[model samples]
Each structure stands twice: as structure tokens, then as C-alpha cells.
Target: MGRPKQFDPDVAVERAMDVFWRKGYAATSPQDLVDAIGIGKGSLYNAFGSKHALFERALRRYRDDQGAVLVELLERPGPVRERLREVLELLVAMDLADSDRRGCMAVNAAAEVAADDPAAAELVRRMLDRTEGAFRALIERGQRAGEIAADRDAAALGSLLVNTVVGLRLMVRVAEGPERLERVIDAVVDSV
Candidate 1:
């Protein structure tokens, strides 16, 4: 029989996630995983099968942890526009505040791994779909309450909001300050 594991797999995955988030998949080495997870190479393989498998788990963990924040912000009780503004503002704040400037993990994964990795692409796509759906639902709520124009298409608006967020997240990687992001927020909120 195999030996019992010494470390918590969940904690290991979280650590791996941090490493992957800070460094894209191609740049992260096996030794990086070994050091971050505090496990030997063989044990790491035994626990997660391979680097790709471990990255998948880490991405899923990011989805559960970071992706949930966007959903929660959108679901907060308030005017739809205000809630959307808060979501955008919070994203800017969080992205800027991160010392590593990692930007959105899902977004980074989409840009880095989505082309060559189908599983990772699908995972990122599903997160985008869920986020767009949440925005669509919130927009519908606003339309029902007469806050948003009834003539506006919620689906299209939702897609635009998702696109805007995607751009904002990517932009934060190169953004010099909050000024440009604030303007983007103003323009998007006004358009909605």
C-alpha cells in the first residue's frame, strides 16, 4: 500500500493556486510547486497526478474563492446600477491593492492557457458565463423596477458588462493609476 499523505491537500492546492496566480502556467516550474506546497516532487505528483492536474484544481479553487466575490457583490441589496458600480470599483480596488498585481486569475488563465488548454479554457468560460448571467439577472431586476430603460436589452447589456469587466481586469495589469479605471466606470455606468 502507498504511504499516507503528510500535508493537507486543500492547503496545498491553495498554495499552488497562489503560485500559479503569481506566475502563469508556462513560467511556473515544478520546483516552484514543490517549494510552495512544502512537499517533495514525488509526493506532489502522487497527490495531484501532474502539474496540469494541480493547476486545474488550483483554478477551480480560485473560481470558488475569487469568482464568488463578484457574484456576492452583484447580489447585494441595492440599486442595480449602484451594485454594478460597486462591483467594478471593488475590482479596481482589489486589483490595485494586490502587491503581486496578479490581476484576475480567471482572466489571466483565459489569456495565457485558454488557447492551448481546452479544460482551462472551458473552466474560464463557465466562470464568465455565470458572471454574465448574474449581471443579466440584475439588469432584469432593474428593468422591472423601472431603474433601467425597459426598452434596453438585458442580454446585450449583460454581455457588455462582462466584456467591460474583462477589459478592466486585463487593463489593471498595465494601468498606472485608478484614473483611467474610474473613467471606464463612469462611462459604463452612464451607458447602462
Candidate 2:
């Protein structure tokens, strides 16, 4: 064997995720990843195969880490409107609190490379679908509980909520205050 790795692969992926999250796949150089992960270029490629592969890993990590939480949040027991509003507000809080204003990594990835990169597009699509599913289930639950109009289309509303999140995340990337985002969240919750 060549020798044991001096650092953890998992930690490297986490650090790589941060670099990719902040700069995006297209913008992040191989040097940037090496600088962030503190690994040699050859070591990085040898470990992860390539930057694309590492980006995929980082995207998956983001989905599994951040995306799953949104689903769990929506699944919390309570009035659907309240749960929905809370989740949206939580997203807003998170995006605003990020000093780098990195926004959602998945969203940024999609915006930057989804048109040309099928892998990134699919990953982002899945994240959107998962969030949409959560929103749909919550809406259906609300309808069953007599909170939402029985005839309202839950699927369409679910997609709308996903759009709401995507838009909110991107908007906050350049936002100076929370007022517009707060209003948008309130309007979306009311719509649901």
C-alpha cells in the first residue's frame, strides 16, 4: 500500500462540501478543494476520483443532512399551517444567519450547472421532489384535519412551496434585511 491517509475522508468531504457550497462546482477550483481539505491534488483525486465525484458526494451529503431535516420538520405533529409557516421561517432564519450568505448549496449548484450537468440536475431535482413531497403530505394532512380547503390541489401547492424555498434561499443570498423574506413566508403560509 502507498501508506495510510493522514486525514479523515469524511472530514475531507465535509470540508469539500463547504468549499463547494460557498463557491459552487463551476467556480471552485481543484486548488480550492485542496486548500480547504488540506490535501494534495493527487491525494484528493485518488481519494475521490475527481472533483465532479467529490461534488456529487458533497451534494448527497447536503441532501441527506439539510434536506432530510425539512421533511422531518414538516412531519411534526400540529396544524399544517403552523408547521408550514414554522418550516419556512426556519429556512429564512438559517439563510439569513449564514454570514457568507452561501444560500442552499443544492440550489446554488442547480443554478450554476444544472443546465449542463445532468448529475447535479438530478440531485437537485430529488431534493425538490422530497421537499415537495413533504409539503404535499402536510397539505393533505391539513385537508384531512379540516385546516385546508378539501378541494385544494395538494400537489400543485407542494411544488409552489418548493419554489418558495428556492426563491427565498436565493433572495437571502443578497438580502440586506429580512422584511421581504418575512412577507413572502407569511404570504406562502397563508396560501397553503
Candidate 3:
């Protein structure tokens, strides 16, 4: 029989997620995974089957973690617009505060690996859909409460908000400071 494993698979996947978030899929080597996961190469291969398999696990973990936080933020009790502004502001602060400036892992994955990796692409797509759905639901709530204009298209606004966030996350990669991001947030908030 083969030897038993030593590392926690969930913890290893979390570590792998951090490495993948900082380094795009193509740039992160197997050695990087081994080092980040604190396991031998043989152990990692045995646990996850392959780097691609491990990455899928890591990405799904990221989705669950980040997605829950985002949905919670959107679901919080408050004025919908204010809640959305808070969410956007929090994203900006988090992105700016990150020393590595990793931006969103899902966004990075969508840009870097989605075209080539069908599984990764589907994960990213579902993430986008969930976020958009949350935004759409929030917009519908605002309309019902008379906070947002009744005539505005809630679905279209939802799409715009998602696009705005996607753009903001990508822009953070090249941003020098918060000024541009702040302006974008202001414009979006005003539009809503």
C-alpha cells in the first residue's frame, strides 16, 4: 500500500489559492505550489492529481469564500445605494491595501486562463452571474422602496454594475493610486 498523507487538503488548497492569486496560472510553477502548500511534490501530486486539478480546487475555494462575503455585503440591512457604495468602497480599500496588489483572483483567472481552461472559465462565469444577480436583486429592492428610479431598467443597471466592478478590478492592477478608482466609483454611484 502507498504511504498516508500528512497535510490538510483544505489548508493546502487555501495556500495554493494565495499563490495562484499572486501569480497567474501560467507563471506559477509546480515548485511554487509545493512551497506554498508546505508539502513535497510527491505529496501534492498524490493529493491533488495535478497542478490543474489543484488550481481548480483552489479557485472553487476562492469562489466560496469571496462569493459569500460579497453576497453578505449586498444583503446587509441599509439603503441599497448606500450598501452598494459600501461594497464598492470596501473593494477599493482592499485592493489598495493589498501589498501584492493581487486584485481579484477570479478576475485575474477570467483574464488569464478562462479562454484556455473550460473549467476555470465556467467558474469565473458563474461568479460573474452570481454577483450580477445580487446586484439585480438589490436594484429591484431599491426600485420597490422608491430609492432608485422606477423607470430605470434594473437588469441593465445590474449589468452595468457588474461591468463597472470588473473594470475596477482590472484597473487596480495598473493603478498608481486611489484617485481614478474613486472617480469611477463616484460616477457609478451617481448614475445609480
- List TM-score per model, in order: 0.96, 0.96, 0.96
Each model's lDDT: 0.93, 0.93, 0.93
Q: Candidate 2, residues 60-126: lDDT per residue as tens digits?
A: 9999999889999999999898898899889989989999999999889989999999999999999
Roughly what TM-score does model 2 have, to 2 decimal places? 0.96
> Alpha-carbon error at 185 in model 3, in Å?
0.5
- Model 2 weakest 10-residue run by lDDT: 1-10
lDDT by residue (tens digit), candidate 1, 1-192: 967559999999999999999998989999999999888999999999999999999999999897788888898889989999999999999999988889998999999999999999999999999999999999999999899999999999999999999999989988999999999999999999
Estimate, for each residue in 59-166, the C-alpha lDDT of model 3 and write its tens digit. Answer: 999999998899889988899889989999899889989999999999999999999999999999999999999999999999999999999999999999999999
TM-score of 1: 0.96
In order of listing, the candidates' clash counts read: 0, 0, 0
